[model samples]
Target chain A: MLREDVTEAIRAAVFEELAAVGFARMSIEGIARRAGVGKTAVYRRWKSKLSLVLDLLTAFAVEGLPAPATGSLYGDVRALLEVAAHALRHPVASQVIPDLLVEAARHPEITEAVRATLLDSQRGVVAQVVRDAVERGELARGADADRALDLVVGPLYWRLVVVRDARLPEGYLDDLAHASVAALRA
Target chain B: MLREDVTEAIRAAVFEELAAVGFARMSIEGIARRAGVGKTAVYRRWKSKLSLVLDLLTAFAVEGLPAPATGSLYGDVRALLEVAAHALRHPVASQVIPDLLVEAARHPEITEAVRATLLDSQRGVVAQVVRDAVERGELARGADADRALDLVVGPLYWRLVVVRDARLPEGYLDDLAHASVAALRA
Candidate 1:
């Protein structure tokens, strides 16, 4: 309980700092200020902003790529996308992840870590869904699972980061889920 | 030829400025300074940075939306994604469009123009492709054209902005193209 609480407190500080100044401008000092923690304590846990923010992102959004066994491909994908959209809609997750990703383009270590974490986490969700669909005969036998996953989840990322507008409407999610099912089934 | 050359030069300079400093940090004065032109000269042609940058982005990449008449859905989509990839690979086009879109989120005028010029232009392209597909019975008569187009181009935008990677492999393009076809035909 002590470890869990401490981890959450640090993460809360990281999220607050990110929301206030963004990931690029956020610092351990600022996080400490916001969290009311000593700088040494914050550094003792994360060592750097990237490391702290990365863990926060992992804990907040990328923690589990849950694959719901909804008994149908469309339902399962819909569940995944809806949950993803909800999780990403958080002020901290949305602000920090995109900024960190933009920053990652310039910083190789950050880029590698972000890429590895996202791809690994996403791939796991996609593989399970695809495998389930294949076994259920809902997906084509030879359909490429990873590519299908990318197609399924890629649009949500685009709408959030590139479009940077209103949240994904229910219609948008439904369309994505339907199209994903169609693609894999084809 | 003279008019085209001048326009190209102006667009190139605007694009370069965008890449150097993001949309918020970039200004007409900065663009003028970078382009070696008077601010009055820029204002005389385009009303604002939003217009100038949007015009350049549309000119550079919007054409990719108009899919070729490739008889088969596969060929048509393959050609479409290829053109989209080409747009991203173009330095000025790739760097500037994302900056403008992100800027549009906070600016009303830019958002309006993005919807009218950039988004509308590509939507038309996708619509035409879907029409052709429907005519050929490649899609169901009741297939939702707008949703289909979103799915088709969504992955490309996702990889570019969300991934924020410097380079995306041709394999990604291939995978998206194939997956879109599979989805459509399913």
Candidate 2:
């Protein structure tokens, strides 16, 4: 396989392993075997299992997030929620994300890396959206952007992942967007 | 030890085990050893490892949740958030709850038990609170209780557990309650 194809294969294998067995039990050999690559090939690119996982998680975080700039704050917030819902609904993500959260809580290094790569970046995107709304006078100048961002993203997450609700109601995203806008305005 | 004391010791040991090693690795032998009881004694009260964990979890769920019925919907919602915040902040709960979520994702029985004992029960409480609001004319007759409950509880759970934020802003719950009320009204 070409270098890029090999890299993609390895990344896919890592996610599969993580989703199936979780971070605690995942091993380099298993990832390599699943990817059809030599163990040395795995070691050649990443120094440790933690580094390998971190690299994959960082890449996923970047690829998964797309900052929306739809004119209205509600539009932008809804767009972001759509992206998040799509990612969270993925089978691999549904399993791996929760497991990673447990791992992150146990390991300070993973927690800090997750905060920087995933949470901070996501927070930054929401902050920019809030800033745009403030500039457009769609939101108050001193509105709590941080709290607004949490409200915008939190409900869908709680339903999809925490409650493990099988199906979201029709127009759920629209309701969430409207409610989030109401919260921010308040 | 007295029967009650023995039971309490085993319960404490289970939480400690769950917090330290997580559900996948926790064992009856380890729990017995930690509690200073025989393995047979541990098995006498619980049929299986899963049952033991479930019993502990159910007990925790029942003890942790206390539905509030304050006169106003806002007051009741704020009261619920405070109760949730207290549970999420507990050292054992902060660790065990996240780990259990991962385990629940992997185990059907755990998932169902959690749904019945915890999520459904909490949702019921929120539903009753919303019902009371509608009766009191504090909310519209046809407000979406489920969505309102998610809006009310999601942000606090996301911040304290998922993001693991060290400190919530002062008056955070109040803001959440007010925003949730606005969302329902809108």
TM-score for each candidate, following the candidate numbering: 0.75, 0.92
lDDT of each residue in A1-186, candidate 1, tens digit only: 376676677788777776666654577888877776778878778878887866665554456657788988898888888876775576643555555554554565766666655666766777888888888988777667656656777767656644555555657778777777766564
Q: Residue by residue across B39-103, what tens digits does model 1's lDDT show? A: 88788789988778767655654454445888877788878778766765565445455444444
Model 1 CAPRI quality? acceptable
Show where candidate 1 strays beyond 4 Å: A1-21, A24-52, A58-62, A92-95, A137-143, A159-172, B1-11, B24-67, B92-95, B116-118, B160-175
Model 2 CA deviation exceeding 4 Å by range: A1-5, A64-66, A91-93, B64-66, B91-93
Q: What is the C-alpha RMSD of each candidate to the true structure, in Å?
A: 4.7, 2.1
